[model samples]
Target: MTKNETDERRAAMALLAAATARELDSAWTAWPERPAVEDLRKAACGLVMVRGRIGGDGAPFNLGEATVTRAAVRLSTGHIGHAYLLGRAPERARLAAIFDALWQDVSARPRVDTELLAPVRARLAAEAAKAVAEAAATRVEFFTVTRGDNQEAAS
Candidate 1:
């Protein structure tokens, strides 16, 4: 995908995750019997990088590794949906992957949005808000004045 399209998709995913979190929280509050997504039995594994670090100005360091958390969901229709997240939280990733697969179904997108997107979006929104607040605490403002500014202002 183009850069803009990729960015747009990321934005959508963020919203979907936040919305889903809210729904999940509400469901847990209103219905004690409803299984939380995380309560569902699931397995998680990591996607790792095999290579080491590269040359730099300081002493040589090993890039070592990074991992993506992955989970698998088996649907009633016999399709298996796999999700890989940048970090741990395999259950959520699995649910999201299942929803993504279902979103491919022409008739299932709306249901997926209602059932999955709403809750996730709420969680993501909370996360994003926290990040923004943290970042805002460290914000720095910078300005520059050009030589031409004096010439232009004199006119």
Candidate 2:
């Protein structure tokens, strides 16, 4: 595949992996049955160190650890898929992997995109917007008053 296509596919897979279990379950219920998927690697959970930079460009530091689950599957047609998700939702990881594999199939791509990924994407976007609005509602703006001496006033 071309670079752009590869990037797009990667982005789609990332979205699938990041989806919540409820979102995935809803999309899965709407999807049609397909060929059986063989587990290339069963879902497993582990801890990974979360890292951060001082100012996003400074030295990196360990923020903490986070639980992560990962799974791999191969469709009957030989397309392979994998997913890594936060927390211990094994089933969610597996389902995400399956969708990733389905997305690679040309015949299934359109259906998977429209039926599965699109709705989840929309829901996620709406939730994010709602969260942003809620946060904005609670926002407190601060202002500083200058002294007559052209110096900043201590508040």
Candidate 3:
């Protein structure tokens, strides 16, 4: 493989990885189940999605009709959190709710955005860079020595 080929692969991987990271970050930031209050409506607090189970190592088994709920929250002081429990645990919901409340507090947004989101993004960038570098490192060049037009060998 030539340097150009390696560079192209690196660019493609970086784009894909960066896109995936951005999407995850967006989902975390914009959870769906937010309350609508008269005075203060906050950014999405938690998200609920239907996930299918694949294996049985105590693993989630998608019954084709069952789903689980997951939530994420950022505390007022910028502590991020996540929860995904079995059978829609109300306690987990409450935990997420509590964090949501804390997150909505006017003081929480800046720190969470700056500290947590920023670092996660930075780490993602670093990982993408490392991946590209590693791929590039493995690139190989192939060449063939052809006979010169003047076939006489130099003494």
lDDT (tens digit, per residue) of candidate 2 on 27-129: 7777777778899999999999999999998999999999999999999989998998889989999999988988889999998888778877888899999
Worst 10-residue lDDT window, candidate 3:
36-45
Candidate 2's C-alpha runs over 4 A off are: 141-155
Q: Is candidate 2 or candidate 3 better by lDDT?
A: 2
Residue 150 of model 3: what lDDT? 52
lDDT tens per residue, model 1, 27-110 = 335432322233132647576764543554655555656666665555554444445556666555665555544454446556
Cα lDDT tens digits, model 3, 19-135, are 333444453466445333221222223444445556645556435433334455554344444434334344433343333343444465454345344555677779989999999
What local lDDT does model 2 show for residue 122? 89
Q: What is the C-alpha lDDT of each candidate?
A: 0.53, 0.88, 0.45
TM-score of each: 0.46, 0.83, 0.33
The candidate maximizing lDDT is 2
Q: What stretches of model 3 exceed 4 Å from their correct place?
A: 1-69, 72-107, 147-155
Model 3 vs. true fold: TM = 0.33
| Candidates ranked, most accurate by lDDT first | 2, 1, 3
Which ten contiguous residues of candidate 2 have the minimum total lDDT? 146-155
